[model samples]
Target chain A: MSTKSRKRMLPWFPGSGAFVDADTAVAAPDTLARVTEDQRLTNDGEVTVASPDTLARDTSEREFATEQWQEVIDRKLVDWGRNPQQLEYEELIPPTRFAIQSAAAIAMLCRDHALAPPMRVVPDGDGGIILERWKGSLSTSIEVARDGTVEVVVVEDCRVVSRQVLSLE
Target chain B: MTSGDGSEPIDKDEIVLRRIPATFEWYNPGLGKPIAWVAFKPNENDRSGISVWRRKYRPPCEVAARNAKPGRRYYVLGLRVALLRAIGITVEPSPLEGGPGHANLVNLSSDAYRRDKDGITQLAKIIAERLTICVDGPFGPFDIDARQE
Candidate 1:
């Protein structure tokens, strides 16, 4: 793949061996640079996952690690959904339903792309959820803000090489 | 020092000490040692202000008194005031009731990435890079609430 004119430039997964942001693409020119949100929009995660092109795959084996990650999200919803106050040290606010749902959708996005399973999926402590994936020095975090917006951040050895926000409304 | 705008000027020489979220701090094997990028994010509740303590006012060891818990342990990291200003942020002293060292790292520009999250995410990444932890501060997540995941 040549993705020069492709309309759907996926968010940078860093080492997905597929997508890289403009900055990282420079350090490693071999990697394909993704277009900006003005040119690339990944609107509905579910629809993106269910696209016809993604329909052909080995779903059974690939579902294990992702299913485990989903459990963490679901558990947070149960623990903090109703209370909305009894968080760690009784200090953090509960995550909104929109945020939890958005996190799940982001997981699906990663699963469909065959990225490594998330290392952590915790509340942002302000009525939102954060989904984090780690690959050696590179960490990709997708956060679902309280209002259902998704912000994707990729950090390599403490330097944030790419930043993008996707609207899930 | 005043920037002549009435708002207190945070000197570039000051050091900012901030409490790190337990779940957000980690020692990555690939990156070597601890410095979680998530630890530097501005809390949404703050609307943009991330609270910190000025080393000149309160010092690192004394800050724990403001936010100490019974048994939980957490990490605190430091970033220079100049490093933040270089990235277009301001760290002004903001005294709170019984906590005079309290200050906030806020956006100098009102637009400030329009809260699209690009500002915080990128800021946190650089903060993590320049983050420095003291030996006295807790390094691991041993005392976090059992309920936390």
Candidate 2:
């Protein structure tokens, strides 16, 4: 038989491409409209009221706090006999870990901000999570699969704000 | 025997396919290792008309070798060319001439036979696919060839 007459099969690559993107900008209509206009400025030499320090503080503070929360989450994951690196790569994090981390992060944020009980944790798919501090005011649901896949969704005023998959362990 | 009348018999041509059972073994003396054996059958209706060909298959080495199991049954099928050559039926060799004399063993590409010592490794793979068995293991570093008597 000719060499080309043999049977062949295709190769396999791991991990289906499933992910979420979260928007961090707090979208208050009037503030967002002003910010959009501010971004369109082209050095017109007009003094803007928006301070760079405030922007820096807002972004950096949350990032630093999230990192600190992640460290604690990492330790907990390791103690639970799950490799954090594998979980991150495989995108499979247990619901227990997700709930723990979410609750802990919210608790830490509340304590730092001196807020009261019943804080809401909303995870946006794009890597941003929101913590609302009102009773029955936020409608966010977390779905977890037995395989350790997590989906977080937020429904507010009949609008979906954050819908995302997160790795907790 | 007492009947004096002569009788005429009618003959009809019919195509018959033969199934011949065969076994192959590879022995490595330096390692004092146990011999690896594969069982297969040759098809009679091969057009190449050759016999005594080598077939390849993936061995369940990880599971079998670790357990020190012997006589593992691997699935395999005989190639028409190899079948014909195995049976002492000689035919014109393909343009590829790597065999001893006119016997043309399947020449698997170098990339395909990267770890294979000879084309027999590829043949084993073909047989395994036909038999629907998983075969993956280190058979040997020596070239396996079909020997006909």
Candidate 3:
């Protein structure tokens, strides 16, 4: 397909709906802008695909490319984190097999909880895995240690509101 | 400098330099995103304490050069010690041989590694939020082969 008029199935979900995968969960938590074939895509890239029921959005080249971009990036992450040496950095250790497994489990948990899929998922530098999400001034991290212990932390405006080990049973 | 046991304190206004690995969450594997939460995650070997350098003892470029290895380059970011402490995070000097500015960014709790790893990680994010890039460049650090760099 040509780069100009690429057909993209924008992962537009309803505001009250729970996300089933990281793909759609990456959208803003409670706010959603619906798009349809009849909606107009203006030259300025602002798609006024909103009514009282829909929200306004800028379907700029970058924003429209994000869904495809995120998929490619996620695959690239798997390739980059495949082994210890692939970790690239000298001091960085690879995420343990268990840590990687826990990350999957945690991602599933996020979907189950209707929470955003991790905005970023990478090695914890301690041979563990960390799944992170940033919502405005709040940041949440679910770090799994080498031993498979999960610590879910929520930090708001640089202050920690909760920090405790979570038993992923 | 020897290992500090908290008897001596790092001044609040002091700038500390942290070496960001290429795979850092915010760095985005050369994307070099400056999302602070991803800046100071504790190293596996360090329990839950993160390694940082007190810039008061050495310049940032010198610190970067000293820590740089052969194959890859390190990107350093500066954070205020006092800003970290304002959120109850500790910046303790634990100088090692040759690197007198070595320090550990420890959590306030005694049982940090097991119970308070989140606090350590949370503070790391805060540190990331307030971090300043030491090297000159945009987005990512300076690339050797780009823009005649």
> Which candidate gets the maximum DockQ versus the true structure?
3
Docking category for candidate 2? incorrect
Summarize candidate 2's per-residue lDDT along B14-110 as a digit string, tens digits: 1111111111112222222122211121112222322221221111221122212133222122234434334332334322332211222223322
Alpha carbon deviation, residue A93, candidate 3 (Å): 2.3
Ranking by TM-score: 1, 3, 2
Candidate 2 lDDT over A1-169, as tens digits, reads 1111111111000110111122321112332233233321112212244467655654464455445545533443233335323222111122245444554543453234322222223221112222322123233434333334444544343244545654443
Alpha carbon lDDT of residue A63, candidate 3? Answer: 40
Candidate 1 residues A11-88, lDDT tens each?
Answer: 444433334233222112222212110122232211112333333342432455457655654665455555554445
Best by lDDT: 1
C-alpha lDDT of all candidate models, in order: 0.54, 0.28, 0.53
Model 1: TM-score for chain B: 0.70
Task: List chain A TM-scores, every candidate, in order.
Answer: 0.59, 0.31, 0.52
* Interface RMSD score of candidate 3: 3.0
Residue by residue across B71-99, what tens digits does model 3's lDDT show? 44456677777677777777787765234
The residue ranges of model 1 lying beyond 4 angstroms of the native Cα positions read: A1-7, A17-64, A67-71, A74-92, A108-114, A134-139, A153-169, B1-13, B23-33, B59-61, B67-72, B96-98, B108-116, B133-136, B139-149
Tens digits of per-residue lDDT, candidate 3, A24-130, equal 22322222222222133332223444343332232332243344335423563445446546565555666666776666565543443333345566676767776
